[model samples]
Target: MMRTPAPRLRTYLSGYVLSLVLTVAAYLLVTHPSYSTSLIVGLISALAVVQFLVQLVFFLHISAERKPRWKLMVFIFMVGIVLIIVVGSIWIMNNLNYRMTPQQINTYLNNQGGGF
Candidate 1:
């Protein structure tokens, strides 16, 4: 399909620059060690989501103009699955923490040869 190299290179460079900016922002937040852990985690997560969207649009070439929107549909499905897994894992861990007493945790740890 007689595509020009200049346009493709431009798209790639734009995506690369955006990705680099997001990565550096995340890195600064992590290495500074001034912010609280929760704040740093939240910032990093937001950066990750922005980077994901940039990759989807630029590198993957996903858009309404493209034929067969199934790629976008599949991506949505995969994202849903990932969100389910992460939410489920956090929910399970919270429930376990609530149900297990400190004494029980210590005893279980000792039983597993991780005694202090």
Candidate 2:
């Protein structure tokens, strides 16, 4: 049986430091609130993507694969599933909001003889 080489300590340390920095930066951005809401959200999202990449490379060691490509394929499939869930949730919420306005809710409740 072939033994795989262990990852160096520096990789983990770097990942930890980068993750910490990104978390602190995101916290500071939210707490300080110097920029516009959209800009802040965009910045924090960018930082989150960077942090994810750092975790993938340093912690998950996805780039260090030797033979099988299944891990990478699985990761991609997981991301797709997550995207589908998120988008579907958002779409469902938006549709519900559009369909159930305040007036509509009152009418619905009144029809059921339980309205305010």
Candidate 3:
């Protein structure tokens, strides 16, 4: 009986190492910047997306042969939806809080005062 050769372990190891490096780099970018919060946040977000793609293609081996493509696709779609929802909620809430009319502000403050 012929034995099949084992898959290359080094490839997987390298991919893991790359992913770790990217994660650390992203973290550093987010934490080290003291003034440019917006720039840091954008860089971190971009890095996260790149790291996720790397993990999916290299670590997870998400390919046609996997046959569970739909599962991965669905997960990605759900993540996208959640991200949009969260970001949109934050933006809308911020706008509403800061841009409210005097009447709206008075009503909100009154409600809070009543609770207190």
Best by lDDT: 2
Q: Model 3 scores what on Cα lDDT? A: 0.75
Candidate 2 wrongly placed segments (more than 4 Å) = 1-4, 109-116
lDDT of 2 by residue, 1-116 (tens): 32335789999999999999999999999999999999999999999999999999999888877667678899999999999999999999999998898998999999999887
- 69 Cα displacement, candidate 3 (Å): 3.0
TM-scores of the candidates are: 0.76, 0.83, 0.64
- Looking at model 2, residue 37 earns an lDDT score of 100
Q: What lDDT would each prediction earn against the true structure?
A: 0.84, 0.92, 0.75
**Candidate 1, position 5, lDDT:** 23
For 11-114, candidate 1 gives per-residue lDDT tens digits of 88899999999999999889887889998999899999999989877787675235556777888899899989999999999999999999998999999999
**For candidate 3, lDDT tens digit of each residue in 1-116?**
21323436775787789889989998788668765888888888888888888777666655422453576788779999998999999999999879987787778888888422
**RMSD, one per candidate, in order:** 4.6, 2.2, 5.0
lDDT of 1 at 31: 87
Model 2, residue 67: distance off in Å is 2.9
How good is model 3 by TM-score? 0.64
- The collision pairs in model 3 are none
Question: Candidate 1: which stretches are off by over 4 Å?
Answer: 1-7, 102-116
